[model samples]
Target: MTLSAAGLGSTTQPLSTVYDLAMLDLDGVVYVGRDAVPGAVKALTEARTNGMRLSYVTNNAARTPHEVAEHLRELAMPEVDDGDVVTSAQAVAHLVADAVPTGSPVLLVGGDGLRGPLEERGLRCVTSLADEPVAVVQGFHPDVGWRQLSEASFAIQAGLPWFASNTDLTIPTARGIAPGNGSLVQTIRNATGASPVVAGKPQKALFDETMERVGGRHPLVVGDRLDTDIDGAINAGTDSLAVLTGVSTLQEIIERAPGQRPTFVSADLAGLNESHLEVELDGDRARCGAATAVVRETVVSLETGEPAGTEALRAVVGLAWSVRDRSDASLTVDGTLGA
Candidate 1:
């Protein structure tokens, strides 16, 4: 569906009550590294109390659901359990089992994250192509190296169906951003000249997997990154909220491509329980609450009245996005988003 003009959806009711499930992306949303995001725990506790189910979804297939759940529990998110976490590993496992026969041997190139799900799907994990595998599946794991990639390449070259948990080129580590499963997949793709059927975000497999297991009628995808999380939401035809506690900045979001735009933008998790202001189109301008944004020629102007801090932000975003989407104009914004 080509979304509404501004690509932003307003809500009169709190999001926590509007949607039955919130498909959340980890690493940037709930916590940064090992510590919980400042008010994440409190906000989530309130969301859960308001009858919203929180499901942690991640493109990182390096960790198992239990491990992920433990980490969330450690961060004092009492609502997160093993059942509440959805990994790309689980998504790929379902894809693999559907193609290859049950109880078949699938060549594994990652670690327990991928292995556990494959086993749960009634498939066996073999390390080498010499083991007579039916298919090959690759994911992100710290221990994967030349040996694993070599085996995966051999299997793919031998005409086995290939699958990947995700193709994210880079992942944020404790040290910094480093090579991710996408980089490794590129290596194999270059060697074998073949692409794996991906099962992560930007593909509906992961979203389908989560909804199938979680049982939610209305699901809202929540994340920090625009390229992956927001794009994934668009691909699945779901509403998305982009939080600012991670890589994506507010200004970048206002200027992003229409396809990558999110349905909502908030500075923190608390916005999950708050009403999202409406952005109404008014000729060559946009208005939200008491704020208004006007685009004349190449410049986009903002007018913020009293008590319209964030509304001013929504105004500019609506104005800028609609202006760009329709006329292909460039708008430069250099001011506070009013948080």
Candidate 2:
């Protein structure tokens, strides 16, 4: 399962030459809150300048595509169009619109950002408990209260379908942290003993939508969380790179499942420029700089069930080893490896 540079049709150019597109995670990969990560803008500009197509994918159910683009522009990362952004709210809206009857009344327990998508689909948004809702759609709302949860709980008990933009329990914010949609969804779930359909990262629907929006090419999914970004990449059959600037920690990356492991890992965007790997005809090899051993061991553990002990564990270590080895191998593109 090793992806060689030649197999990717890059023997003369650099490994970056083989990747046609990059799917970037907004919150942690590019910027945190309002401040851009160090060298994030430079890395993005360089990638774009080098001719790589870029798309920003997020699980934030609070922002619309337009709002996301505005945030990116404000952060001075890279100018991205609405078409290049995807949000859980948009995905959930599509799900609701397709499944539920058109113009059905929906009990929205979120903000205007999340409600906008459903409204755009012609769904009636209702806040009153007296209104009969066909479904309960939950998203991020700072003003969430017990009253809203009780209303949603009653709706679910009355046989209304429950849907959540994302089940993320915690959301990153400028004011430390706050409960995510997952927490709110959990309250309702616990109260009504109901389950919610999640429409965010790690869900195949959002990934499919993203791929379709990006024209379905071999793209690299970059993010900070292993559960969401890396898992989404696995579900989408794409490569992923994990950065340490967000929710995922070094220990977590080391313990990720093989299918959920990232193809590349870096401290931040700053080190990504120097990050290089060779995708040979046989397999991929990564160059060791700082976290090479950790990446290698993690990949090995993922590929094979063997522990990260000194002994090389066996099992389906082929793809995992190849991925680990090529993390810094010299890839050949069109008979020439890029400098």
Candidate 3:
């Protein structure tokens, strides 16, 4: 696959045939909340059958890996175990373990997700600063509140080593979008005027951790979010696929700078088994398969053909980015996505 700005790659073989391992992100990529996305089980099962090692790597530090595996199994996914899953909790724990004394007491601001990994790494978990903790580590949990943040604030204010699983400002819930661990971390940061060493997405640590554990020669980072999942892959210099089953939209992705874009795009996990069509660019136009996109002044139009939706989007995105790279003119591709 050619790696370049606005260079959506094409392959004669399926992605499962190209990559040895798949580093998956939870939430929008696999399951949202307590349920699995439609056809997720089937798609993943097929990818596994195609000899691609599937590793669930997530920034969500709320649940233990076992809990995540259990949830996946309950949703009728393949026989997934805790070892097959990696969390930001584990990533942060590794960072903390490398820096601090073994068996040291750490002020844990989250739940057992943080506690389990810390203890596994020979670190101790404590709730209060009165415990004489050596460091403060935080993650996200629904139950985290003022008291925990207060303890973290106290510890951080006093110059204790602080580490955080991630800095995602918001997380999606069954109800709606809500504050994530990063949001709470911001509260403590504001109070203490300190920043914790982050180990999650957009940081290279978590992906590196996944690589160490999963042991893949060629890995594909797959997720729905641009900021964390796709951008994290870019940060790690890894190939990524942005699926539309979750938060980000086609329109939003096409407008980003080249370095921030994913290597591939698909409507869902089902795209894993399909041959990708490359977006070919002409003067002021882009084409993918039967779909064509042309720039008419400041507005970009995706002219529909046999296979429109995503193909047209690929063309439009290529054209939009090509235009962006040449001039500072803004593109308007608002209503062309559904075409």
Candidate 4:
């Protein structure tokens, strides 16, 4: 893969008018824990008025689509509906159903979310290997204990088809980051010495299902994560917007690997309505808007600009990424730009 990180193409029109559909990541892009990210509800409402259909695509399989939509509704997001939400549970359940016969017994190691989808696909959820299960589907649930994992391991050791709702290593909670499904999946993998087919972000199944459900001819993936949301957009051959209201940071963007860079970067969802300025490269200097950044060897210097704003950071990121890409060298921010 050609790792071109700088000088990504520019957009003349606002993204809301350019894309027919917006596949939004729920956790970071829309909300964090139980609260809406600042300005998310308002921005989404305006984007809808601008004629962009928004679909919430999530890797969290603990909650059903209805539950997620209800949470969004509680957050003042009235446009969200059960149908507009797609979960990893639905994707893994579909994967298992297609491989097994209709109404076949399948072992479940997760919660109601995982069971709901499997049952909807006419697959029976069995807990034990003695049930003659043809497959095993595991996800993350607080109630999922060692017993469930042991049973899943037994079934997997027998060569049953293994599937996972999502492999997100860490999940953000009101209490802070906690172990997610990927961390739990490692338990069974260590025990049975087997890996599972994942059906979440960074995988194409969830994106494909979201597109099919929302019917977006031109879809823009809006997310706050680089590894999953942004990389998943690249995997699906779609454009993406990276929001800084979540896990990713300016440092991460400065050294983004191939397929990890987003088409646009913004402080919040309000960027949907604004046009992005292209980064202009002049020799070793990169400029965007009123900000200018110069990269000398592996070091980057922000001479004068809005150090804390998006436009200046965009220019600096362009120069930093370009320098790293050309020489395969690391980038060091000169620390002139204040936080």
Candidate 5:
């Protein structure tokens, strides 16, 4: 929604009281491949030290929770327990085990890590559908082949459930980029024209699991991707912080509708802790930083494609105050209106 002065003062609020739990996206938010983002570790540690509960949620299907934890340790991040990490591999396994019969045979087209969760769920993993499998489970398979896709389609066509771990088409890899599970899932779907049940971000199940793991009065989701992380937060009925370290850019944020807009946005995790202090509103954007009072002004048309007016000016200022309240920032308005 377009920012108006009337709504500004009412919306701003201090951020400290706005969120209790922070749901962090691992890949883009914490690091890109093996290199950790600057200040990621410090930001997260500070959040925890400030009494905020933290949990790392990832869409990486290639790594298991234990493996992910070790990777984080190598990056010098705070220690995370096994239960604190969630992955698409784990999500798919949970879905399959809960829905399908125990000990059911399923054709797995993914890596050893993806298969680990399935095995733990008591599902027997097979290489092909030759055994008349009960289902076809797909995740990120770096060595996937056309033969595997054909076999998965065949299994699904035979009345077997087609389950996909996630729909992330492109996964960031050390070697630039690699095809993710979505690419394979689409290939199988194109062959059989079959739609499998997806179990990952942008889905309610993943969000539910995350909230359950990091319980809080209010949880804030932080991520760089719009489709998965942002959508997930919206689905979970929680606020979100869209960082520019990953998929979405500043232009995309400017063009987004209010429903898709994050509660806060920043260059990286570095400025997140300052979100509760002060209120900032410039045109369509709004942000908060820790401070006692904030005031902002911008010139804009009273009507769409029309000239500016005193009414339009007052509207935006009021809107900034409203935003301050939402961010839990304290506010005070003065009569000195700038032209």
Candidate 6:
């Protein structure tokens, strides 16, 4: 469904009470690298106490659910258990099993993350096409090298179906961003001129898996990235909240593309228990709480009675996005959004 001129949405009640479950993106939403995002643990605990079930979702296919849960526990999130985590590996495994017969040998190009789930589906994992494998599954693993990719290419050339856990081009690390599964998938795609069926974020497979694991009457997708987490929610036909603790910036969200906008915006996880201010649309102005934003000609201006905060930013996004949608007006927002 298309968002109205006002954009995604607004809510009077706290999100924790309104939604039964929260499908959260792990890397950016919960923790950065090794530490929890500021206020994340406390906010999540409060959300759970308020009756919201938290489900950790990720496109990273290298680690198993238990490993991810352990990492969360290390970050002081004791509430996260193996059952509370959903991985793209699990999604791709089901996708592969549905196509191929159960107990069929599938060529595996990933690590234990892919092997464990495929085994659970009764599919045998093989290293080579010589095993007479019926299909191939690829995911991100540090050990995946030329040999694995060559075997996958051979299988695909022999008409074996191919599936991928995710197509994310980059994975963030302590040093910097590194090549992710998508970059490796691109190599195979370029060589064989064929693409694998992807089953991750920005796709419906991962979301479906999350919903199946955690029952949600009205699930709210909580995340930090606009491209994956927020867009995934749009694809799944669910509402999403974008927090500022990770990769996305206020300006980036203000100029969000179609099908990539979020229903709510907050400084951090604290938003789960707080009411989201509504962006009220006027003739040419959008107002939220005490802040108003208007676009005249090629300039977007922000006017606020109080100091600007997350709610004020939402007003600016509503006005800026609406103006950009209607015309080629340039957005002049240099001094509007504070640091």
TM-score of each: 0.91, 0.78, 0.95, 0.93, 0.77, 0.91
**Model 1, residue 242: C-alpha shift (Å):** 1.4
lDDT of 2 by residue, 1-339 (tens): 243322221123332445677778887778777888777988877777767777888878777788888878877766578788888888889899988888889998888878888998999999765788888998886787988888888888988888888887877665656677788888888898879888888786777777777764667778888888888878877877677777776556544444556766556654334334332223333222111122233333222212321111111122334453446422221111000
Whole-model lDDT, model 4 = 0.83
The runs of at least 3 residues in candidate 1 whose Cα sits more than 4 Å from the true structure, single-residue gaps closed, are: 1-5, 282-285, 290-310
Q: Give lDDT per model, in order.
A: 0.85, 0.66, 0.85, 0.83, 0.67, 0.84
Report RMSD for candidate 1: 2.7
Tell me the deviation in Å of residue 241 in model 3: 0.6
Instruction: Name model 4 segments beyond 4 Å from true.
Output: 1-7, 296-301, 334-339
What TM-score does candidate 1 reach?
0.91
Per-residue CA lDDT of model 5 for 1-339, tens digit only, reads 123332221223323334677788887788888988877988877776777777788777777788888888888777577777778778788889998899998899888778899999999999777886788888876777888888888888888888887888777655666667788889988888889888887776676767665567777788988888888888877777767677765445434444665666566775456532223455334333221223344221222210122122233333444554455443333332221
* Ten contiguous residues with the weakest lDDT in model 2: 330-339
Off by over 4 Å in 6: 1-5, 257-259, 282-285, 294-302, 305-308, 335-339
lDDT of 3 by residue, 1-339 (tens): 664325666675789889998999988889989989888999999998999999999899999999999998899877687788999999999999999999999999999888999999999999988999999999999899999999899888888999999998888777767888889999998998999999999798999999998789999999988989999999998999888877877777867876688888877887788767777888788887788888998888866643335566567777788888889677887573632
lDDT score, candidate 2, position 50? 63
lDDT by residue (99-186, candidate 4, tens digit) is 8899899999999988898899999998999999999998778899989999999999999989998888888776777888999999
Candidate 1 residue-wise lDDT, 212-271, digit = tens: 988898899998888788889999989998888777777788788866789887777877
Better TM-score candidate (2, 3) = 3
Q: How many pairs of residues collide in each model? A: 0, 27, 0, 0, 49, 0
Mark the regions of model 5 whose C-alpha exceeds 4 Å error after superposition: 1-17, 174-177, 276-339
Mark the 10 consecutive residues where model 4 has the least summed lDDT. Answer: 1-10
Clashing pairs in 3: none
| Tens-digit per-residue lDDT, 301-328, candidate 6 | 6777332366666777777778777774
The lDDT, on a scale of 0 to 1, for candidate 2 is: 0.66
